[model samples]
Target: MNQNRVQASEVAPRAGLADISILANASLTSVTGTDMTSNAQGNYDLALKYSGTGLASVGVADKKVLVYALPAELQGKVVGGATVDIDANLLPITPGDIPGVKVLFDALGVTINTLNAVLPIPSVVAAFNQLKTVQNLGAYQKTLPAVVSADGKTISVEFTQELSEYVHQAYVATFGSLRAAIDALQGGNVVTKPLIDGLKLAADKLFDVIELIASGGSDILDLALNGNILGDMNGTLHTTVSDPGAASATVKAGAINNALISADVLTAIEQEGEAVTLNFPTTAVNPIENYDVAAPVITQPVAGQTQVAGQVTLTQPIPDRTTFEAVVTLPDGSTKNVPLAADGTFVVDTGSLVDGQTISAKVVATNGTYTKDSPITTATVTAAPIENPIADYNVATPSVAPLTAGDPEITGQVTLNQPIPLGTTFEAVATLPDGSQLTGTVESDGTFKSAGVDQLAAGQTVTNG
Candidate 1:
């Protein structure tokens, strides 16, 4: 016989939503009527009341977010034994209230619970043709407000509804395209190239989920109805991590990672950020369908490409690693095959290279394949790490000869002699007659590679390597 309280915000907007329609039909005076009750099944239901032209359009938001407990049917759910419902009738509006005002309420007494959203609240694919339009490209460039406002109130508990599978696919593809570049944004980590394809697959799998949400969100983000797209996203769960030995992991798409990212990851440049890891009770994570877009793709350059190093990129949605493959056809009709670096990247030394001849680039990746006719790149190679630029081995030795990233770029293996000073208990610095540089991460047994051995002073050799 206990009663729960639920209050609706008057001036709040949906979060992360850019464009939408609103439906306002009526207004309300007060929710003074008190009723103690059950749904005849003896279960408590949370009841809401409102009036005004708005009432006709105010569909309920999801009370139980994905990361949180179930809605009404599942245990540990928000409606936990209590039933929440909404009722409405016309009433004259006051000074602060409008012609159509809504009142959200909750009540309880029952025991069974399952998470069923009030509906209209939650839930993409691709084509190269659509890439031509600026508007089409901008469709996914929405800047969902970190927080939104409506009628004078801030919306805290909000979620994105009206998600499209096609759009989701597009976003995923785009992300996959940029998978290699993502490394530049996130803190340095050894990401296998395959993760890019996995992310796209994940994004594609979201179509089913998009359908589920689209079917139910009849009035969720309609601009004609609720003027603001932002929802009252209160008490929404964001992350889930589980022990590796669990039987299964029921990680949902919206399942958030409070530790890694939140609403912030939705960006183009992709600066330093975190990852969202989900956990389930099972040994492997069960897939929860969701929607996102697939980014574009650009093959490398051609032979006659004016001396500039050409590159390939992607934009995928999944966080798993992926492999990317590309083929280069030389001017003489010979083809040179290449694979992405450890983290889905590839590099070519164009230095001793020539131009003015037609060349082509071929790419076959996890998602699909792309071919560029007569593509061209240049012979503009940047300086690799400094080679043995250190001096004074007799007085003071250095930690590393060339101290920068992107050298020995593929293996990440380095070679450095004992940079120790006096050569007593510590290792001795190898002094070459020519005087160049050398060094990298030395393993327990004392073996490493120099950073920029590729571009070095002629005739300088390190005994360590």
Candidate 2:
């Protein structure tokens, strides 16, 4: 087994049903849909709805009802006495053939809902993006082998675990990781501020989920919270240092806030089967006032810069001398020290830049401490913009010819306007007297040809051919 690449069995995704009911802690506070359930008449009937329809969410809004497609090894594996397994390896792979292993859960309708976890308020883009990516991959399919009992009465279902199981393993593993990062970071107030801001952002999103589910959209909530990701980010966190290859440049990024968000409040609601809603005072609390952050700045060669890329540029609100140094690093991994310039400005030379190469730079004080300025890239230094004749092009101005008597197509090419590159294909179309049309390609000599003229009648053409 290759440790670097995940195995096939580990990645097989479990089929899913995407809807769920979010009842109040006990006695469903509200049924989102009309009457909650429909009858044979399809009329609303909460009592009947709960009894029938076999409609339940497996924790995803739009996934198919879960029917684990079994691999060969565990043909008759079962979980908690369910035996819907057919052999796929022995079954026909070609169309119209039943596979050897087929595992189906009996008319088992499930109510899938979100298990709210503390999402650090600050992980909007990165965390959400990761969630989306994981969804595409499908929570590592766990319905791998459906086991049957000796008497063929009881059953068990299990799957080869992957990194994903950790996602659902525990809230501590997920949320705890961020807590550890906050504790481990050294930038005093500077770094913690952004982290708090990120958490607050996540809180707002959680509130949105609460409202969506309470209003009959449990499936949407399921999608947002189903899979576990970024749950392993525990303990030590290294600073991300930006690199400036040749000359230095500066990048500015959003600040992190350290506002504390208690995820327990939200998760508790979810535990009780009640949707969580963020109810803030109407006056609103501005969490970011006086966010303490280190003004750590770095002086490094910019990324993707050439030998002559310009010198380092500092962003506004430069950090104090304590947080930043006055030197930059070149592409060769050598340092270009600054004289601790009074005005927070420094320079790098183009003579040190290399041609046909790219580089970047970042600002840090203690020889690779917390990064201050964002990294910036520069195009390779070159004598001039390289010109490639093959890449250049000219579009000839087109000429329009009015439809003539019984004319079915429009035809005109400007031979004198410009010389089109060789292998260029052009076309013109015409509508005949009848309502028909034609189209075709152009030739090297700038000549116009047409098709579909035959489709038009001599006196019945209406529009462009």
Candidate 3:
């Protein structure tokens, strides 16, 4: 026998060998055949030769070196000859070849028959198809919930754990000491200066945030959440995570219960009853009850007034238990607190004030717990001008005229030693011998005429009255 180089195996004895079989298998499961040989057309042709066998028993037509050829890697394991078929393509085979052919046939889930059957071959192919739709997922969106009362006065917010964590991170980033303190606290360390400072800083930051949210809108909170949309009560989304949107959260403010107090300078008089009255406008939301209102205003002196005094009236009547005060800033800049009467009125003496000096005044109402003040008003001191009354006047002799008609008349002009005012009036009286008197008033041009005077003789005395 020729020395076999590939492997030394038993060659079938001519007495026992009835057919030829060939098997090709790789040691590794994957295809790593670097020495694969193929024809120019990319077809792998493998030839098998056998000799000196019971070839006639195997139904060999001629014993002159029978040869069989098959495709490399295409053929399966060798076994007893049997019928074989691949994708409707058949090969000459016997019952013994069925096992080896069934390996490839059964792997493709195809079937074959060894007796009186035409084989059908199956071809395998692979392909990749394009998808009809695709989707991209990114970070999740977040939102902070808040509620506002109907009156739009008070607003409350509940922070989520995620939001709280974010706030903590923000605090730590803003204050370096905060991070250390937090770490120490997490590590169960004792309180220290840094921890106290951190706590103060955190409180301040929290208060600032609260104030901002309370005073302004929640645009800041929305920004912190990195969400474009705010959630509404109706579950409507207002913003998007990546782009700006017109979504806003609803925050209804409740009616404010506290009193809305305000005051103004109503009347600032510098006359004999010099007084200032502060008026508070009417409020509907929060009534002016259970509260005191005060205002301080500067009152300037009137043209001829010398004293300053004031009063205040609230929209609501002052409670009986409330105490009122008027804080007066004197012309010398000294201040005095004077009690106010139940009528919300007060008076201040201006004797110490000089002419043209300004005084500041303010009124305050207090109920022990709550107090309100009016705006400041100024008052200036002034004195009335001096004047002397007229003492005497001159009366000219009366001219007697007989009335052409029914009654006798007396006519005369009254003159003053000192010029009296143009509008001043003087009276003239004429006494008759009968003890009756005739009187008349002076006219604008300084003439007086008495009507219905007693008839007198030419010499009868008609005295000027």
Q: For residues 1-465, could you state the per-residue lDDT of candidate 1 as single tens digits?
A: 123222244434433211121113212111222222322222223222212122222332312111222211222212222221222121211111111111100100000001111111011112211222222212211222222212211112222342232223332243332233222322222442233333334333433333333454323212222322122221212111112343321211121212122334222001211112222233322221121212212333443333322345543442222345555555556666677554444544333334344455544444212222222432222233444534544422333343233234212233344565442232323333357544355553443344444533445444433
Residues forming the 10-long window of minimal summed lDDT in candidate 2: 104-113
How do the residues 258-339 of candidate 2 rate in per-residue lDDT, one tens digit apiece? Answer: 1111233222222322111211123322221222322323333333343322333344343222244344455565655443
Name the best candidate (by TM-score). Answer: 3
* CA lDDT, every model vs. true structure: 0.28, 0.30, 0.36
The alpha-carbon RMSD values of the candidates against the true structure, listed in the order shown, are 34.2, 37.0, 44.4
lDDT per residue (tens digit) for residues 225-251 in model 3: 232111111111111011011121111
Candidate that would win on lDDT: 3
Model 3 accuracy (lDDT, Cα): 0.36
Error (Å) of candidate 3 at residue 175 is 87
What's the TM for model 1? Answer: 0.17
Model 3 scores worst on lDDT over the 10 consecutive residues at: 123-132
Candidate 3 at residue 117, lDDT? 27
| Candidate 2 off by > 4 Å | 1-326, 329-397, 400-410, 415-426, 429-437, 443-446, 459-465
Per-model clash counts, in order, read: 129, 94, 61
